[model samples]
Target: MKYVFDWEAFGGCLGMLVVLALIPIGAFVVYFIFNAILFILPAIVAGAIILAIPVGLFYAFKEMVFKKVE
Candidate 1:
């Protein structure tokens, strides 16, 4: 009987381990990005709403004044 060390099998196993290790890391990154967007989304929407109110009022007044002028 002869003993043989299979380098190809070892390399394949090592590659699989690396890929498995990266899966959780990739999932965590995706989760963090999603959570950050969720956290910021309300603030972004509120800011837009707050700014829109003033801009809308300004445009309404401008149209009213311009209509009276013409």
Candidate 2:
């Protein structure tokens, strides 16, 4: 059976998806030489931290601040 529609929630999700799709546009606009270097260095550092950190704490905080244990 099909669930009844909620247009408001659908519209909100569509808006979020549109905003997310704009991220690559911003990335492309940042391809200028100096700006590219500026962005790339920090991204490398952040990636290193992701790889360096311990697995459990890394994934937990990366996803959310407080995760409950059952």
Q: Per-residue alpha-carbon lDDT of model 1 for 1-70, expressed as tens digits?
A: 4345456655655575465456545555655777765645555555565566557546643443333321
TM-score list, all predictions? 0.41, 0.43
lDDT of 2 by residue, 1-70 (tens): 3345456655655575466455555554555535766677555555555464456344543334333344
Candidate 1 Cα errors over 4 Å, as ranges: 1-3, 36-70
- For residue 41, model 1's alpha carbon misses the true position, in angstroms, by 21
Per lDDT, the best of the predicted structures is 1
Candidate 2: minimum summed lDDT over ten consecutive residues — where?
A: 60-69
Per-model RMSD to reference: 29.2, 9.8
Positional deviation of 10 in candidate 2, in angstroms?
0.6
Among residues 3 or more apart in sequence or in different chains, the pairs in candidate 2 whose N, CA or C atoms overlap within 3 Å are: none
Clashing pairs in 1: none
Q: How many backbone clashes does every candidate have?
A: 0, 0
lDDT of residue 64 for candidate 1? 38
* Residue 11 displacement in candidate 2 (angstroms): 0.4
